[model samples]
Target: MTHDHDHDHHDNDLDPMAARVRALETILTRKGLVDAAAIDAIVETYETKVGPRNGAHVVVKAWSDPAFADWLRRDATAAIASLGYAGRQGEHMQAVFNTAETHNLVVCTLCSCYPWSVLGLPPVWYKAPPYRSRAVLDPRGVLAEFGLVLPEGQKVRVWDSTAELRYLVIPMQPEGTEGWSEDRLAKLVSRDSMIGTAVALAPEAA
Candidate 1:
């Protein structure tokens, strides 16, 4: 399974933590304490079988079904579990909707308490101190850094994720996508959008 490390733009420069992880993996593999093939299988499962695609399906269902959207808002855990996307750091889920008036942003102030079941591993930046600190202190500024500039009148709501509960941001459906199929709509739902770092991709953008 191929890991999607593209989220880290600094692919050429490994951070200390990443370097340590790689070193540990190498040591374990060399010592026969870990099976490299098993590790690859697990990573592949999360990357291809259970990553952002699951979140995209959830978003598409919410976009196509108003009742599901209401249910998701009322009980995100049960709603998401209903779609067979519940596990680990995603046992308790909260779905936050982004509207014209309000934009939702999620951050784990203490550590990275991300919903790995649906979004796969947390991006490096999501676990970085700068994002964790500024996501709450200067959400607009942080969003701007991600190239998502919200309107001045729009209210930014920052949700702090915890070990007990994880937050998923349901971005607003893009315009000019009327009559589109759920599969097509799902294509526009990006991992960053679910994390509130970016909005759903525009039809033309795709």
Candidate 2:
């Protein structure tokens, strides 16, 4: 459940959205409008059971099997569903592939409509207004902020996620992974890669 991202400080600090959610839960529980235990169970499910690991599995499979990659590109919802990763926030899915000439980025311009079924709870930064607006207005700048500097000629294409549909970025396979197994490849797939803020890890890095 641990991640190596620079935002590890978030683990120590109470996320702003989480603080708001807790306040709302308190109000709802006090008014008897919501079950506190039920809410806790749901949170536990996402925190423990559903997470980036699920999305990594999908990414690794696509990397190892070209046919699966084609199917994911054609019918992401069904292809992802076939892997048992379909649920709320991931009903309608679209897979965008990262290639040598183009990089893909995902953002929910209106709100944080993320693929919770695959990637678990949305990160606090993902729901921030700055990321939402800038991702659409200046994707290259946003990637730079994430420390991902794309090639000069590589185009950045941003996808806006909606309530009805969500997007997953298929990062290009890294080099020196010619015959890597799916399990090993999955280790190289990070949550940011699927979100397109980063790319798959290099073999040595993994």
Q: What TM-score, computed on C-alpha atoms, does each candidate reach?
A: 0.79, 0.82
Task: Give stretches of model 2 more than 4 Å off.
Answer: 1-37
Q: Name the top TM-score candidate.
A: 2
In lDDT terms, how accurate is model 1? 0.92
Give each model's clash number: 0, 0
- Write candidate 2's Cα lDDT for 85-149 as tens digits: 98764369998999999999999999899988789988888999999999999999999999999
lDDT of 1 by residue, 90-162 (tens): 3689999999999999999999998887788888999999999999999999999999999889999999998
**Candidate 2 residue pairs in clash (backbone atoms < 3 Å):** none
Error of 1 at 146 (Å): 0.7
The whole-model lDDT of each prediction reads: 0.92, 0.90
